[model samples]
Target chain A: MAYKCYKLESILTINNLTKKFGYLTAVKDLSFTIKKGNVYGILGPNGSGKSTTLGVVLNVVNKTSGDFHWFDGKISTHDALKKVGAIIERPNFYPYMSGYQNLKLVCKIKGVNYSKIEEKLKIVGLLERKDSKFKTFSLGMKQRLAIASALLNDPEILILDEPTNGLDPQGIHQIREIIKQIAAKGTTILLASHLLDEVEKVCTHVVVLRKGKKLYSGRVDEMISSNGFFELKCNNQEALVTLLERHNSFSKIKVENDLVTAFLTEPMRSDDFNKYLFEKGIILTHLIQRKESLEEQFLQLTDNQTNQI
Target chain B: MLRLLNIEYYKLKYNKASRVLIIIYFALLSLMSLFATIKFNIGPIKFHLAELGIFNFPYIWHFNTFVASLLKFFLLLVIVSMVANEYSNKTIKQNLIDGLSKKEFILSKFYCVIALSLISTFFVFVVSLILGFIYSSYTELTIVFSDLEFLIAFFVKLLGFFSFGLFLGMLIKRSAFAVAAMVVLFLIEIISYGIVCGINKGTELADRIYQFLPFKSLWNLIDEPGSRLSAVKEVAAQIGEDLSYDYSVRWYEIAIVLAWTALFIFLSYRLLKKRDL
Candidate 1:
């Protein structure tokens, strides 16, 4: 998919946010910004302050200390949550009320035009099931209604904490597509999830938090490519290992089954290694530079915090 | 604010609870009125009984009869379910998160309860007016405007009781607790009335304490002026007849009700604003 080039502007700015729950520090001095129309993410293991960070930003939960600004400082959530719609944890609804009625309640509170509600329901593809009681909805359907509820006012900033948590594979894909469509129209989305693959596919920017502290915050691509590795799949692993061993530039190697994976501090030396290996009669079935998986990079960054990794 | 009201009204109109509540309440009142018409025979005196707006039925308009028979219990149930459903369904929290100012959140409920109470009371008022016409035609009884005065009295009574429900919603943001407390308070008020007036029949101290029964003040508002049950007489007796003539439509009572309503609303608002879902 061709990505839309966005004019980079910080839509959400968090300055030194920290929150404490009793004696436990839930979010520790976390700071990051989500650029305009950016699909920003917070990726961490469970209990890693991901949800807490979103909670603080949305003002559903209190912050011990911090500040957040929205829309390039035109408005901040402090008094401007009117423009922000969010769902922090499980989608909560009046079980006895129909999905349409529940979203109506959200619209009532947000003071939005009621006609916009049908538009949101259609966007989330819940128009057909809008009249069903919330209790009767499947978990995925309930989530869609929840997303529809969040979009009731057509908020400029949509913050969803684990939007796909209870969705099936198809449901997850549907939600992802809906989010992408919304973001494509220039709505900023802030998502928090532990699903590395999902984050890798969706997030343009990411802030990796480990045990209440930010370990990485920047463009998602940069974080993944900061430390590159060599993924080598060869017909002759023994010959390939011998050729790579001849070079002191690479730092670590692991052989699994018939493939040899190596990490190199200096990825520039790979061309020279390829030439040497070619001359030595080792067939390079595959020689590809590997960007670290979000999972691997998360593990590496948060490994210092014993509990978080 | 009007939009909020319209949206809230639509929500209530579509809800099963609202429709069911009106039907069940009207039915319950009808059943109670039927029982009174059939079982209680006052010598040679006829009564017009209206069940759920059925006119010229059998029994005369009796707010006390309805209060004693069913209105109190029905009101308690309605109030409890209305507030409790919000908590159980998590809609209240969602409302706050959706951008309602804490005050609007609480005010919306207060206004809803008031609207429901007025609706219920209006039905009763219509019944009373029809009963007055029937009583005037069939019996020696002459229906007076004083009877109409009861409507105003009912309005004030609705305010107090509605605020009572709001208080319950605030004190216990849980459905079980709010509903239970409402039930318990209903019983306590009824029992206390029996204890102070019936069992302890003639004691002066008991009579004085009866003056302070929270619900007694409400009932007194509707009672005939010179009757022993009249709250007006009770107030007059306490501070002399001179004060009674000076007092027109107990501003003090209205003030007290307003104060209670404001206090409970503020408390509910403060709690909602400060507490985490």
Candidate 2:
């Protein structure tokens, strides 16, 4: 038999989704899209609507207004959601049930075969504790079991909200490694987290949010690779600022604590800028070139947003 | 329907509280058979409780069902907590994310209620048969099978009560508060009966109105079999009391309780549908 195979680029799309808690808007007109094979990160601080957005899409939290759909502009039906595994906030299960029992229930709901339960449990490293009750498992084991349950059907897109919120360093590392392996198998992932470094290590695209608003959304590299300001100290900081202020390459220049930090307007290598400064007769005792860190960019975005409010 | 019930089965099977309550409920149901062995004497009133024709054909059905229906409270705890745990553990939200729709979740609980009712009804049927064979003098098949509506009424009563518990669990979202709310509602019915009968100085109007109350209507399904016993008749005769109450199952009362069962399940579904988990 011959059949047609449809290729959908956008695995999940949200258009102006908004959720309100009476007087408080948990998520406000938020919109983003997750394409196939993209490890998307929803980067935000606490109470910034990261979980709320994921909740609305997963249909756990009802949206006050707006729309979201999965798989090629179609409305999110059970079939579409069955192929999208998700865990919102913390891992929730029947506390009295074992890890295997919890996954068995999940498999029943997702209509997956029971044989996959052990395989998924092994993936999360819960095979050793499969018979232990959920209440008996530590928080880390509970999270790993949740991830196993989510992967029972081999979902096309995995949505995780604060998956590593409360774990020790090793536990966090283990969770990240599991996520990395899942993504390596070519499954699209949408991860929401308040940890900047976690997103830096796992995500390919990012949407930065603050106070229920989107501050930035683009490739992680683009957000980090923007025209970054530099920090340099020389004997004559005043001369460096004055000489560089007239040049077409530098847009913004500031002098603080006997140091000069300049933002480049046009694309120019650090070596070229240092050459220009050297030719201007300003010798440098300290020459430091720094690219914008995700932390700095995230802080600047949220800070600017707070000041605007 | 099988899929939904299968899902509910795993959840209830693995829950420790549910397992304990289920065992206790069935144990209590089975313990009712020991009532046939009671033979004692109260001063000047020598009596073997089983010899009073209480276990006689037809009456055995009424007596057994009425007694067993009182034990439905145990399974009601199971149903209510089953819904309550979903909220407390937030598994309902996870279930939805795992692709179980809201409607399917409600159906799962409803199916559980139905299954519990059927199983308890079957258990009561079997226990009554054993008790009847041991104590009943009338051994005819027709007599034994005559008044089986009481069994059907028992099943309906359980279904209504457990559905009400499920609805309350969904509405209250806490096990203790949901059970407390059920008590409060029952108390409201009792107080209303008191006020209505007190104002009119008679039970004539109150009796007519009490038939509409859902909780009282469940009791109306199987009129108390205690008053029909010969021992009670002799005692009431000595006190010059009138023993003229209806002691048979009424169809309208069963209809009323069945209607309430559908309403409670629907309300439970609506509660889950509107709430943001």
Candidate 3:
């Protein structure tokens, strides 16, 4: 098989990793593998345990059962963590310390040189603000400084959780650019984000999670259910959703807000879908055949949520 | 180990509050010399603190250390607040993620505690030597260095007390609560000792039992040196008082406090290791 022709070294491997808070399972039986240079995206909704899974692997949050390995060991080695750079949750830093001092602290931890601090800070455009206290920076700048800190060790793998969250559009754009620049250099990255566009824009492979359960995990291309999915809107969106769910023409369908996106089971056209809906006493107010991978991935998630719920 | 201490050094170096508290603590430790110049005359009699032989070596070692040990709460507050800052800033989690093992983190804190205790001990040693040379009548080299064990006892006392602060900081994760917990623990020991004494009708059983308690062991490191003053002894002798008390720093007391310091450090490590961050 072509798959067996090449062997990739696994950088991180999680097996049946689970975390429970009281009775609530933040992540359950979650398993995945990232070989060298894999831009893995953990895609999910807001409360879908994306951060929890990353937290478990990082050893900042304890697991309820199962284990994960970095490099070759079953348990996390401090040396292995030293090789990997990560930013969990917010951009945690000492507010009174300057950007330089905070990064200096990380250098001490990772056993890196102080000179490397200037180089990495320059990469994120934080060199000029290196003397400023961390609390004085804007949220965007804080996120960028975190990225700089993460890159100081020349990390083997970078794990970022919701990196662009709570940022303006321009801030999001700059962060994405930095991530892309790093990914372009063939650095392995495990990005956990709830934004579908973020995963679709940057991730090569994605693991879809919802409410602590893994719904899908594969390449970005394979996540698409069919060639494309159809999106339709009608005045009576309630009746339209019910009619579409009852119809057998599409493999999967869901209503989010006012529009309903339906995945084609047998490759159907938008006109045919509209005509079928029209004959059933429903008139289409808006129709679109979204061929973009974003819609296909988005519908896949919402469809799973609708099915599971 | 030096690397860990270096990390903690920079952490406290940048913190404004810790810096201020440290300055105040050292200043107060040195300011203890001001008591020597406090001489006043009323009518035909003159009373002078330095004339009381408080600075008489080797008794100066005991006197200075006890007075200096009283100021340790300032540095204890600094240590507690530093730990609480780590939590409030969520930097503790970041430190773990950045590759510091939980054991290393706890070791860094322990090293900082040791450093604070050692520096305070050295500072007090220098200040006492200066004050003794000016006021103590026995300036012989042998007399000057004879009872320096009080400096060692002072180090152990501060080490144990600050380790307790570090443990409470980790256990509570809030500076105010950690301080409150220290006060509450002190009260518990005092109240329990009182009850034990009241029930036994004397301090025989109570002293025997409470000797092993953390604070009791700390207080025992340097028994109060006030009664050892020549003036106090002369007055007591004239008043038909025996004035027979153990004024020496005992090894058992130092060993017990060292044990408590080790226990507090172990508990702090356990808390750090078991916590989820």
Error of 3 at A67 (Å): 1.0
Each prediction's TM-score versus the true structure: 0.78, 0.95, 0.91
Q: For all the candidates, what are their Cα RMSDs to the real structure?
A: 6.5, 2.6, 4.0
Q: What are the clashing pairs of model 1?
A: B47-B58, B47-B59, B48-B58, B48-B59, B48-B60, B49-B58, B49-B59, B220-B231
Over B1-277, each residue of candidate 2 has an lDDT whose tens digit, in order, gives: 9999999998988778889999999999999987877888889877787898989998999999999988988998999999998999999998998988888999999999999999999999999998898889997999988899999999999999999999999999999999999999999999999999999999889989898788888978988888888889998999999786877788898899999999999998888878888
Candidate numbers, best lDDT first, in rank order: 3, 2, 1
lDDT of each: 0.70, 0.88, 0.89
Clashing pairs in 2: none
Q: Write the per-residue lDDT of candidate 3 for residues A1-309, one digit (tens) a residue.
A: 568527878888999988899899899899989888779998888989998888777878889998898987754567789989899879999999999999999999989999999999988988899999999999999999999999999998999999999999999999999999999998999999878788787888889888888888888877765666788888988888788777776677877888788876667777777788889899988899976566555665778678878
DockQ of each: 0.38, 0.83, 0.72
Mark the regions of model 3 whose C-alpha exceeds 4 Å error after superposition.
A1-5, A74-76, A230-263, A267-288, A292-309
lDDT for each residue of candidate 1 in B1-277, tens digit (9 for 90 to 100): 6755665676667667656766787766544435335433488854433322222222234353335323645655666666766777776656666776556766777777777667766776655555546433343344333434445556666767666766687668665677678678768877776776666566565645644445655544554333322444566777766433321245555555566656667777777666655
Off by over 4 Å in 1: A1-10, A72-79, A111-118, A231-248, A253-261, A269-271, A277-289, A307-309, B27-70, B136-143, B147-153, B185-254
Misplaced by over 4 Å in model 2 are: A1-8, A73-76
- lDDT for A94 in candidate 1 is 80
